[model samples]
Target chain A: MKIKLVFVSLVSFVAIAFLIYQWWPSPERAIKNRLGGLAKTLSVPANDGDLGRVTRVAELRHYFAQDVRVRAGASGPEITSRDALLGLIGAWTPPPGGWTIEFVDVQVTLGQQATSARVYLTAKVSGHDARTSEPTLDAREANFSMAKQDGDWVVTSVEAAETLQRPGSQD
Target chain B: MKRLLFGSNARLSLLRAAVLVVTAVVVFGYVLLPVRLQGISMLPTYRDGMLNFANRAALWWREPARGDVVAIRMAGPRVLYVKRIVGLPRERVEIAMGVVIVDSVPLIEPTVVYKAPWNLPAFTLGDDEYLVIGDNRVMAMENHDFGRATRDRIVGKMLF
Candidate 1:
């Protein structure tokens, strides 16, 4: 009876430990949380004041690395530095209905060293057309390369993943 | 009522419930991926907010044939595009006045209800490449998401 009790305790302890490990904050989870925060920050409210807009855009710098590279589209121009990206973001204007940005289907692959990760996700943006005032929803796949910097995951590079290539275009 | 709900033994009933849940997760998550249509890209045939299933095992026996409405996976499977296959592998595909031409032959598309006068230069698809486009041609060619997708990107065929 004593032996059976010990065996049951051992199994229960192991099962609890395994569950805890699975629930613990992992690198992938950290990166996903960071990306989620980034999405929330990127979303704009229609009634946002000028101060809120500037503050939100300024907060974007914390999510990116200093030497971050951003490519909005396959053919779009690349932004080399975080400052440049923030500058463009500050100058951006949202429609009357504002913009909602969400990152879904986020898949994170950790690097061999565990200090770096590559995230593949679909960026869904919903807003109103500036000219027509019609609601528009656009989704595109994007890749984000991030590294652990000062105990935070900071995006180092971002590129839009174009699943289909344009006709007659040579890349 | 209690016996009918929990069977003769509680442990056996719990085991059966677990098995049913596992089987459902495997079947729906992998075999038949449930997808909700989002945009007007595939108008007329599949409207917005329509629920459909993509059979991941549909192309197991044969390659994807032309005119098959397939799910085009983006980076991962979380989000995908539903498009109709037009140009097969190694075929030259071009859009002249919104009519798709394959190898200098005007392809007949029955699902396309509206056609925009869109012109695209002819381009030859590489090996294992298939051209995919939405059914709605009313939208401008530049605004629509249609182009050459690789074989690996074609996840599965749509099951209406």
Candidate 2:
């Protein structure tokens, strides 16, 4: 009876330990969850008027630090400052046919210090221009550096990593 | 007399199970990892839906050489990309008309399946930095995403 009790106890302990490891909240999961929400917020259609769009853009600014440095494309100049980044977005005219944006393949890695994270993701934007009504399709790969500020993750910097060709499109 | 801790049959079975588990962990964890290709940027070398093995053991002792196909570690393992390393550290790379110019010399890339007019100004690479590009260069300069990948970004060599 004593040996049987020890055996049962060992099995129960192993099972409980496994359950804890599986359900524990990890740093990678935390970063991924934050970035996932950010992606959804960024992909929201900005077809509303400049004022409405600006409000949406303002929602984006809250995800970033006050002094955020952003480079939109590989050849684009780096804009430093939250206002400047928003200004660049505000300058854009909404598409006449509406726009569809998607962020996919999001991968996040926590920094060694545990206070920073690096994210790599792909963004696809397709729509028609408001002025000329020309169809526009843009796909890009970007890397974002995020920092933890007061228990909230905020974007510190963004770099345009690569420009991907739309799949199945002939070069 | 020799006696097994467990019965002879059970001991042999447990030994076989342990060996199998160890082999699987070593092979899948560090030696060879399977990945699915997502895009046609690699073209004739790797198809869009083909399965390939990432040879992590390739870079264990040595750095990757130019023209070697490699997988890069992006934000995480799930978003890694496969590309060929072209420019090594300290080398200036420029694309003129469809050819790659390295330090004023034309770089010989035999695996390039297509060549499109890609004009990029010369940029010197920093230490521990590498220029990675796809084999399908026929894609327009604007469409293809080729850029610098630092040492830590590279995950391992790709085996087709």
Give the clash total for candidate 1: 0
How well is each residue in A69-122 modelled by candidate 2, as lDDT tens digits? Answer: 999765679889999888877787765466776556677877899899888886
**Residue runs of model 2 more than 4 Å from their true location after superposition:** A1-14, A25-171, B1-11
CA lDDT of each prediction against the hidden true structure: 0.89, 0.76
lDDT of 2 by residue, B102-121 (tens): 99999888888688888887
**Candidate 1 residue-wise lDDT, A77-143, digit = tens:** 9999999999988887766678999999899999999999999999989887788776777888999
lDDT of 2 at A7: 58
Which residue pairs in model 2 clash with each other? none
Chain A accuracy of model 2 expressed as TM-score: 0.68
